[model samples]
Every structure is written in structure tokens, then in C-alpha cells.
Target chain A: MNKTIIEIVDSLEVSKVYAELSDPQSGGICVFVGTVREVTQGETVVALEFETYRNMALKEMEKIALEAVEKWQLNKVVIRHAIGAKKVEDPVVVVGASAPHRDACFEACRYLIDTLKERVPIWKKEIFKNKTVWVSAHP
Target chain B: MEILLFGIAKDIVGKSKIQFAAGEGQPTSVKELRQTLESAYPDLGRLSSMAVAVNSEYVRDELILKPGDEIAIIPPVSGG
Candidate 1:
């Protein structure tokens, strides 16, 4: 197995991902951090709440990291997510990759975040002033 | 068998876990489990999409259920 860090915590540290993905063999490092935005569409968001199926989410995250490492020849990778309530401007998720070249790191970083959103068993709820809505739960 | 619910599914079911008593006619497959849940809780049926996971991995509806298997309902994911 490669050097991959996958964690789901109550708080997310934006700086930890960069340090975790540092590798002497890597020439480029790319990261994507998702935060709780204050607005969505026309609604003003107060906060965001996240929940996860812990065991499954971790397994899926590890699978995604391993796949990225193999596909992009990455030297190091990290995927971390925050659960519970997050205030606006708080970091919610972070994904990053370090690779031998810029192209690989960039591509893998995109893949890491995108695929994690699609496959991982994590859910986010949007808390507006008047209503709290579960993201993508309905048509 | 017991089915664990998470995300919107948990909200719809109003519980974190659903236990199917053996005498109540247990679902023998993933497809049947989905059907039973949808009928029991119509809200779950109205979701945009959902998936089933067995043993911490996504599985097709045709997968057969076995004793002591870990099953969960995976609603649409929005994590980034």
C-alpha cells in the first residue's frame, strides 16, 4: 500500500493535508478544500451538518485514494472530511495528491475530490435560516 | 437481518437502525430489502437515488443476504 491518509473527524485541519502529502519524490502537490459557504443558490446558509457511515465511508475513501495513486503514479495522497455541525467559512473536506509531475498531481487532485463526492458515503445537510435541507435527497 | 440507515435515509426512517424480526418475514436479497423499506416508508422511495452496501462495500440488488451481514442504505452523497 502507498502512503495514503484517510480520516473522518469532527474538525478538519486545512494545513494537515499539505504536510501529510509532502514527499521528496514528488515535484508537484495539489489540494482542494471544501468549505461551508454562506450562500447557496438564493438562500442564505447558516451552517452545514455532515454525517457518515463511518466504516463504509472509510473503506470507500481508502479505495479512492489507492485508485488515484495507481492511476496517477502519486507519491502521497490524503483525504479528510469533517462531520457534525460546521459554521459558515469552516473547512469541511480536504483532498490532495503529490506526484512526480504537475499534471499528475493536478489531475489526481481533481479526481480525488470529485470521486470522493460521488462514491464516499458521506452526506451534507444545508441549514438555512428557516429550513434545514438534506443535500440532493430529492428531485 | 438489520438494515442501517444513514443520511436522508435515516431521516426518512426516523431511526438509525431497522431490525427485521425473523418471524416478520425477513428480506432474503437486497432488492427485496429495498422493496420492503420503500413500502414501509414511502419517503425512502421518493429519494432522487439510493444505493445498498453490504459488508462495507456497494453491492447490486441481486446480491443475496446472509446471516450477520452488515447492510446499510446509502442515499445520494454530497460530500466534496
Candidate 2:
């Protein structure tokens, strides 16, 4: 059996994510953190604003975690996403995976983040010096 | 029925939810609802892509909107 933790909050603490994925039987724990960048295509970004259809996002993340555990045979999986405004370098997401060995852990970690990007219902917008725009959407 | 909005869609709609009369007095399919929205808010038509969710589940545009069904407009996702 595997454990899955999914959260959507205003901020994320990597240590907390690491703590959640810690397992005595696992030799490797892979963690991924995504942060707001200061620039995009040469434009300075002041901040990032993230939003979600909370219920749907949660359901989708949970499904991904459960499926990753089955496919990768992982021991544990954790995903945390931050909402609201975030400054440059502020962590926006933390995904962690632990397995009995390193291979499954790394693959599951990558799968979780990649699948989340393709399926999760969260959205982010870059707040530039004078205006805000979605990462990619109606301009 | 109320159509909920999020992200850029919320900004364009100017609110989180709005009462929508998709088919007046009859059942409205998801595609028809989208057409009505596009007509009422042309800005929505500008979206690169969008989907409608029923009861927290994203379904095809052909799914009919029923009374009391929870509807949401999902824009392109960019979360990492």
C-alpha cells in the first residue's frame, strides 16, 4: 500500500513535503519544487498569482497520486500547490515521492508533476511591472 | 443554473458565478451553454481553450446541462 498527500494552499514548505514523504523502508525520496521566476521572455515579473478550482484540483491530484503509486509501485507520494500571490523565488509547488529504491521514486516524482501540469485545474498569472497576464491564455 | 468561473475567466466574467439561461425553457447541452457564453461575453471566445465541468467533473461539450447541475468554466491550466 502507498500513502498520498495532496494540498492546495497559500504557501508551501518544502520541509513539510519532505517530512510527509519520509519512509523507513524507502532508500530514496525524490522531491521537486517549482517557484515563481523573476523574468519571462525578457520582461520582469513582479509576482505570480495562482488560483484553482479547489475541489476539482484536489480530486485530480488525488487521482494522479493514487495512479502513480500503482504504476510506479511507490511507497509514498506528496503534492502541494500554493495559491494567492507569490514573489520571485517563492515556492509554488512541491512534489515528493519515496520508494524502496531510487528509480521508482524519481520516476513517480516526475510523473506526478508532469501529470499535474496536464490535468490539474490550477492556473497562474504573471504580474508584470504594469499589467498581469496568464502564463498562456487569452491576451 | 449558475456558471462558476476561475482565473482569467473570472476576470473576464467579472464575477465568480452568474445565472445562465442556456436554453430558456428546455434542457441545454454543454455546447449550447458555451455558445450562449461566447455570444454574451465575446471575451470568452478569445480564450485559447476552455471546458465546462459538471459536478466537479470535466465533461464533453455535448453533455446536457440539467437543473441543479454544478457548472464551471475551466481555462487553460498553467500550475506546476
Q: Quick one: best lDDT, which candidate?
A: 1
Candidate of highest DockQ: 1
Per-residue lDDT of candidate 2, residues B1-80 (tens digit): 88899988898889999885545643388988788788889999999898888998889977977789888999888999
Candidate 1 segments exceeding 4 Å error: none
Per-residue lDDT tens digits for candidate 1, residues A39-136, read 89989999899999999999999999999999999999999999999998999999999999999999999999999989999999999989999999
lDDT of each: 0.92, 0.88
Candidate 2 residue runs with Cα over 4 Å from true position: B21-27
Which pairs of residues clash in candidate 1, taking residues 3 or more apart in a chain or in different chains? none
Question: Residue-wise lDDT of candidate 1 within B1-80, one digit each (tens)?
Answer: 78999988998889999999875579999999999999999998899998999999999999999999999999999886
Q: Against the hidden true structure, what lDDT does model 2 obtain?
A: 0.88
DockQ values per model: 0.89, 0.74
Ten-residue stretch with the least lDDT total in model 2 chain B: B18-27
Model 2, C-alpha of A58: deviation from truth (Å): 0.6
